[model samples]
Target: MTGFDPAAHLSEKLLERIRARAAAHDRENTFPAQDLADLKDAGYLAILVPTDLGGAGLGLAEASVLQQRLAGAAPATALAINMHLVWTGVAKVLADRGIADLRFVQEGAAAGEVFAFGISEAGNDLVLFGSDTDAAAQPDGAYAFTGTKIFTSLAPVWTWIGLHGLDTTSPDASKLVYAFVPRSEEDDGRVVTRDDWDTLGMRGTQSRTTELHAAIAPADRVVRRIDPGPSPDPIVFGIFSVFEVLLASVYTGIARRALDLAVQTAAQRRSKKTGKAYSQDPDIRWRIAGMALAYDPLPAELASISRDVDGRADHGTRWFSLLSGVKHRAVTMAKRVVDDAILVAGGSSYFSSSELGRLYRDVLAGQFHPSDPESAHATVASAWLGPIEP
Candidate 1:
């Protein structure tokens, strides 16, 4: 519940494994098998678990720090791990009332199985907007979830799923609660992911779409009722902040790799006009410096918000709104920074051979997650006054 310093808690042995896997994992677009195994063995997947339980009981601040460091090298691995951790994090949010399947997710986190969220929909620009999809309650103590869910990352690699859906009949949107379910079913595939993730970005993420068209058994449903109307204000806004922080970490890591690779490869890049090290060229130096200018100062700024969020201190109209502003700023800055890295790294940055290229693609995907800058900014502004619509 307290006194957890994620900066200090990170295991060097585990990091070495993540670093070791960074190349081949990204290259082959293979699963981050080692990183996931290491994280599970380390028991970090139980992060944010209730203090009453035997968990470390850490806060978002600690988790964010770990994510920033571990993910920067291998985002695919970091993100795959996050699928479980975020599910763990959100499960705790709903824990007060008791989500029956939660204990399963908790034990799974400890035992090495992971649960992923199924929210995105097909044809949606930014995920988290909820699908045009809808659900209905049935007589069998279950609901027939018969809509498509897009961008369900880690689907191929997970054991359980946490999903959010809409019940058109609800009176309030906040009532649209999140639920937990299994990835497999002898009855039918309660959850299924489409194989549409083959792309130029986040190759290994396996972020594909899914269709839920089976009986969501009663005891299996985490939270089945809702009063669909307006959105869950501070919670929605706060989730945005959480996502932005993670997205920024992904890009920052990519940019850091860009700089590192550029510096290392500079020596071999000779001038076309003259035989000279590219590292010594002023233009090349300036280009790389620009990336540095953008890369630094992001984490501390995100960290700064922790002081406000933890204390619920002075800020915008609501605690979450205040974080939204910071999230937007961090994401926007990361976008530009990586663009600069891409430009400086040259044509190579566009090829899979170059790590920066993959980094660039994954970072680009961050811009579209949950919501984009435009929607995020609008949401923050609306929050200054009150909750947002749509």
Candidate 2:
């Protein structure tokens, strides 16, 4: 299917309804259940799954564009669903490279199964390299994960959770086991979802804490068992590449929306002293210009990087640096754009009801996601400077 347009799949009326639900969900601190259902009904959950597998058969570039649009309407809902898309995107990345290890993930997404990412843990900076969660091998070769996972998005509703843990009993002692745990209440009595998602912003995400006490990932579902730390494994590259790009897409969308709101406010509100629209004021124009300057390059850059990933263009060892750099740039730029937008919107924006205000709080969350500012810097430095000498 040539000339595929991802945007055409989602209707403006559908987006309006999702946008209408955003503030209410944020105010009530509730997940956007209806939004997720609507997106699923629209076949959004299967965007990356191949057409042959009963999906849209789109690529990262398309998904990134759609994510930016979704985030503009409702950031929390977009962010929550991003975790599920990450897994499906990773599965697509792997499949493109002749690996079908995650074909079930594709099939599951196409079948409307919700997959949540469960890799995050408290005090674990070694992300994807090492794990604080325990992975004990059972007599049947299956592994049991026992530990706490923080920032577990889609915590309230997930059919499967992809996670990792350290298996000390292995020969290397730091063997990281990567697998998916099914959401079975009977076999997994130890899994606990804490009712504590209250936060400064992005309240609709419902990213609660999860306590996994010996949650089981059957032997057949165990995807990878490799030494901890960096490796040439496709799984590692797939996750990093897809996760960082899609994440950048969400934040870039936030910036785009904030900038748009600022423009609208400037055009409508008049300055009392000058008795003219804020859009005519040199100062307001300058602030909006600054926001545009910061926001303009991001979507294009995101598109380029995403296409490179889809095209399987080889950046060799530079892939990590590129992925992390784009993510870092998007987050920092989005935050700046939102800050300028709030200033342009004036005191009215300070109200909790203001979408810009909520966006300001939501943009703050970009810093905390994986491959954070510090890690991105380190990865970029390592890419250019090589490993630092002892």
Candidate 3:
């Protein structure tokens, strides 16, 4: 029960707690404190850190599966925990593959020290923006940093924040630099959080504005100067594919639960509007059929990406397109399926005490989650169009 066993290693107990907290504080928009604590306690948060650092070292494939599974279990915690997982995965992948020796990031991750990333700026991709002057970096052996890194997904709960800012002195985008600073250190009332994240969706995410006031240290800095430029390597592309695949794969599970709830309620509840058995309607059958159809492709797309990554095959831009497509379709379909449930189930879906409301909002908002559909299309089109667009 303690070690890795795929199907048997499910975090049912932890997932239950997450579902509870998600429903409880979900309306309050607070951090999933208890759930996150459970994640660290159960070793579910730091699955990517090396064993030497007291972690599971299950690799990226396992990591993606775990994230996707948790999303089905609880989307709120899955998302918050995702910020931690991405930092750990990138730091570990970078270190182990001789890309960068972020041994400190590794040990810190195992100790339950959550690391956050600052890639979402005013105008760029949150997922490691491909910007030269638009990225984050450090100056020699110094920790104090200055840059406007916004909308850090886990700002409220993170210990270390991976700040990727533009190295003002450098012109080389290939030499992509990164810095890590303690959020506590930046809490001198210097950093600012704007209230501009009042979006119609994913409101509970608390993804607000983070404004840097001063400088960051050097020892805490992780990825020094590195050529983060163009590489057709699937491994490099796999890093991105993993998140896209996880997002898609996870929503696939949510859709199943939504469909289950809708169909089950149909048999038990009689619609006052029609004065007929809800289960006896043609619309109900068609809805179930549609949900079933929507549920099919997500896992297949996830499997395709996983199979490719596991095999270490060449990941062309076309592959990136496929992975992005999986994410795009999954979230969009999940939103559609949940919206239909709301329409069919009516007032029952909005009952605050019910799972339907929370799940519906989370799943619906998930469609707009940071994985950019436009960019995914662009990344995919790069193959057919040839080279990245200027």
Residue 315 lDDT in candidate 1: 60
Q: Report how far residue 298 has shifted in candidate 3, in Å.
A: 1.3
Local accuracy of candidate 1 as per-residue lDDT tens digits, 111-195: 6677776766657543444445556655654555667776676767777666666666544443454566566652376656667
Which candidate leads the pack in TM-score?
A: 2
Whole-structure CA lDDT of model 2: 0.92
Q: What TM value does model 2 have?
A: 0.98
Give one digit per residue, the lDDT tens place, for model 2 in 5-108: 65576778888999999999989999999999999999999998999999998999989999999999999999999999999999998899998989999999
The models' CA-based lDDT, in order, is 0.63, 0.92, 0.65
The residue-level lDDT of candidate 1 at 189 comes to 66
What's the candidate order when arranged by decreasing lDDT?
2, 3, 1
Rank ordering of all candidates by TM-score, starting from the highest: 2, 3, 1
Give the per-residue Cα lDDT of candidate 2 at 196: 94
Error of 1 at 339 (Å): 3.2
Off by over 4 Å in 3: 1-9, 125-140, 171-175, 193-204, 227-239, 271-277, 351-354, 385-390
